[model samples]
Target: MKIGLYVLSIVCLLLIGCGDEKDSTPLVETTNKNQKPAITSKAIEDFDYTDYALSPESEEALANWEKYQELAIQIGYLKKADLSFFNGEIEDLKKFIDQFKTETPKQLLTNSIISRTAILETMLLKLNENLTLENIDDKLKLLSVRELLVAFSNLNYQINKKLESDIFNEIQPE
Candidate 1:
């Protein structure tokens, strides 16, 4: 009982010694009234939607642009060794579409977007479909991978037309 009491006392003293002064700043209270400018007005509220007609192609192009942006983000997680060769393909695709439309046509942009999207979709399908089970060499797998890589290479030709010079100038193989 004496040892237990001594231990308890020593713990209490140690804890007290470790305590620091508490912060004493008063919290500031803010009210939104008189704090900021008004952002909306009735003058901007009555715009009619029927007068604006976006072409299907333009919509498709926009969608494809967003998709490529997502792909670019995905590529950031990929190692340069794994994706270096294909990284420019999507960029080339963007350049191609950019050149073909120069401001993608309303009707044709949609078809182009669909076609571009299909390429990624097909590539993904091929990747996911391959089941390289236990060292049985897949000739089809090699062929598909080679084909997709080549396609990506061609796409990079356009996508990274400017950056390819930089990539080639930078890579130093050991």
Candidate 2:
């Protein structure tokens, strides 16, 4: 009876120890802030994009670009706030952004625009990494989503600024 009890204790200890195994995936480096992460689901439409009309050349380029269409659809998914397939949507967005970075249309190839897209791509990658962690919290997920939206908005602003400048240049006396 003594030996059986000893063996049972050892088995219980082993099970407890195994239960504490840490996840292998590394966490994204975060600031040691004690504050709770805020949900920053700002509406994309709030950004003033009205003044930056795309030129006919840019419109035609976007119309013909399947990657750009895919990008827009992905953004639409994010905008919808549908949590059912949110993980898959983020994954899809990351892939589309990667492709868009390399195949930007000629009319949209300004240095600033390209730089902004690169920043957006980096944000998406970080979000993807965060999602891959085994113990992701809602705060981290929401914060990452907010960051992703901000990066995309910045890219849109750059593109619009470039288009506006191009239009202004065309109307100016040479």
Candidate 3:
């Protein structure tokens, strides 16, 4: 009977020793607003659209300059690489892209411009959809944003190229 008690006590002591230690320190709940993840550091590079500048001629051809301005502002937001801000601005960005695509200037209404806009629209929709899903990856969101930005830049480049071609053709001998 004494041996039995000793064995039971040893088992109890082993179980107690194997138990997880509970932290006695109370966790303070502080609301940390706008907390950025460490992975976001230097994740996106600054986009310079200066080289892709629309000539004065192309700028003047805009059916809705305000739409273009709004797009520029959104691009600025993307350049800042703030994922949360980008997620919040997705709807507004969609509106801007839709307006710009629909109201494309007559002079710049090339197949390339149309295709680029379509690509951009698709990318935005995909990103927005991913963000709505449960436990979406941040890296995936960043990649989508990058692709969308590239599509926008391509649209600008196509517009400038088209405008320059038109201008050059006008100057050539008939």
Candidate 4:
């Protein structure tokens, strides 16, 4: 009976010790109301294709420009979702959309980017109506916020691939 009690006490102490091990990382919440969440350490910058010497009328330039516009729309959606979560400010998101519009090349304004932008606009409107970080999952039915960010990264990769291919094609003698 004494041995049984000792074994049970040991088991109980082990269980108690295991329960005390909580995560040690400190949670640092952003105190500044105006600050945006640092989702990524790197900031997304606008790409200027003119450095590539891509002529406005060339077929490759047109294709790459179309891709660039699509990528910008994708990035816009991601930024909208992120800002909505962090700041819950509709005006900020609208301004982000405006930035994309102003940056797009005039000749490269294709139907693809326009249609995607319309969809993103509708999403922003819906988000504005029900602005809460808790409902972000429900708001973006097809993808969670993390997935949307991943999609944005993938779009960036696609743009890089297009640029690399364009450069390679230019180097090869026709």
Candidate 5:
């Protein structure tokens, strides 16, 4: 009976020890903060403007809109980088955001754009507040930030298509 109990206790201890092992990989690193990831040329190539039949003004606006999307991707990568290098990138991102805000025609402000702008602003505010690594809940916070960037990108694409349609309707002959 004593031998059986000892064997059962040893097995339980072994199971507990195995359960406690954790992977040692560091979640986020600060080393590559300065390097912006390459923006793939294919992203722009994939956009089919020819089929949209956009007016000249709409085409110009579409270019600017695409520029904003590219900048947003850069900003997303910056947001993922180390805290030390985030401020400079944030300033650059703000400037890009401001350019679209001020230069894009007021008539192009769809309800979707307004809602997305508000959400993006909120996410930026959260990011700024949690800039330090110590403050972040690694998985949850990082995932939220990533989701926000994706939402912004998808929303920006939709806004571009809507703008093209709106502009095309304005210029089309009745």
Candidate 6:
């Protein structure tokens, strides 16, 4: 009985140890924050992006309207990367996003518009640098897209923080 109990304890310890195993994959380093794990391209692509569901833009263009609309648009473009089955369409996505800058009311500091925007530009440049669809199997290339949900969340937080003052509480419907 003593031996059986001892073996059970050993098994329990092993199980606990296994639970703490470090993730085998490493993510690309992001300067956005110091506390959270640097999100990897693979992890990013693997994430469920529906959480940032963007609704059709309200004509009023409320304070958060830009964040919501852009997120939806960004996700649609990113799907191209996912369908490639690897990193195949990353370059195309980058080109589309890069050349897509347009002036509009909801354009916040973190949006693709405003070349001077910080986080948007950083993400643009990073996506451009990685996720190139070159020479690899189309299926294999699909894996390069990173989870943009985190990136999107970060942008929302930044936008809210920066626009707290000037942002209209709720734009009155015309």
Q: Which should have the higher lDDT, number 2 or number 3?
A: 3
Q: In model 6, how large is the Cα lDDT of residue 45? A: 53
State the displacement of the C-alpha of residue 73, model 5, in Å, after optimal TM-score superposition: 5.5
- Give the per-residue lDDT of model 2 (tens digit) for 105-174: 7888888888877887787777776666648876676666677667766766676667767778889575
A best-first ranking of the candidates according to their lDDT comes to 3, 2, 5, 4, 6, 1
TM-score of every candidate: 0.28, 0.58, 0.64, 0.36, 0.46, 0.35
Q: What is the C-alpha RMSD of each candidate to the true structure, in Å?
A: 21.4, 11.1, 5.7, 13.5, 11.2, 17.8
RMSD of 3: 5.7
**TM-score of model 1 vs. true structure:** 0.28
Residues 113-133, model 3: lDDT tens digits: 788778868876776666666
* Residue-pair clashes, model 4: 0
Give the poorly placed runs of model 6, Cα more than 4 Å off: 1-71, 76-116, 133-144, 161-174
* Model 6 TM-score on a 0 to 1 scale: 0.35
For every model shown, the clashing-pair count is 6, 0, 0, 0, 0, 11
lDDT leader = 3
Query: Positional deviation of 64 in candidate 3, in angstroms?
Result: 4.3
Write candidate 4's Cα lDDT for 85-155 as tens digits: 42357776677657655665564355554554455555544545443554454325323333434433443
Return the top candidate by TM-score: 3
Give each model's whole-structure lDDT: 0.44, 0.66, 0.70, 0.49, 0.57, 0.47
**lDDT accuracy of residue 68 in candidate 5:** 53
- Check candidate 2 and list the clashing pairs: none
Task: List ranges where model 5 is wrong by over 4 Å.
Answer: 1-59, 62-70, 79-100, 167-174
lDDT by residue for model 1 (45-164), tens? 232222222234333444655544444443333312243323345555455434533443343334434454456456644533442232334444444444444433343333433334
What residue runs in model 2 are displaced by over 4 Å at the alpha carbon? 1-61, 83-95
Candidate 6 residues 58-131, lDDT tens each?
22343344534554465555654333322335665555455434432444644432432444545554544454
Candidate 1 off by > 4 Å: 1-66, 73-108, 131-139, 153-174
Off by over 4 Å in 4: 1-87, 105-143
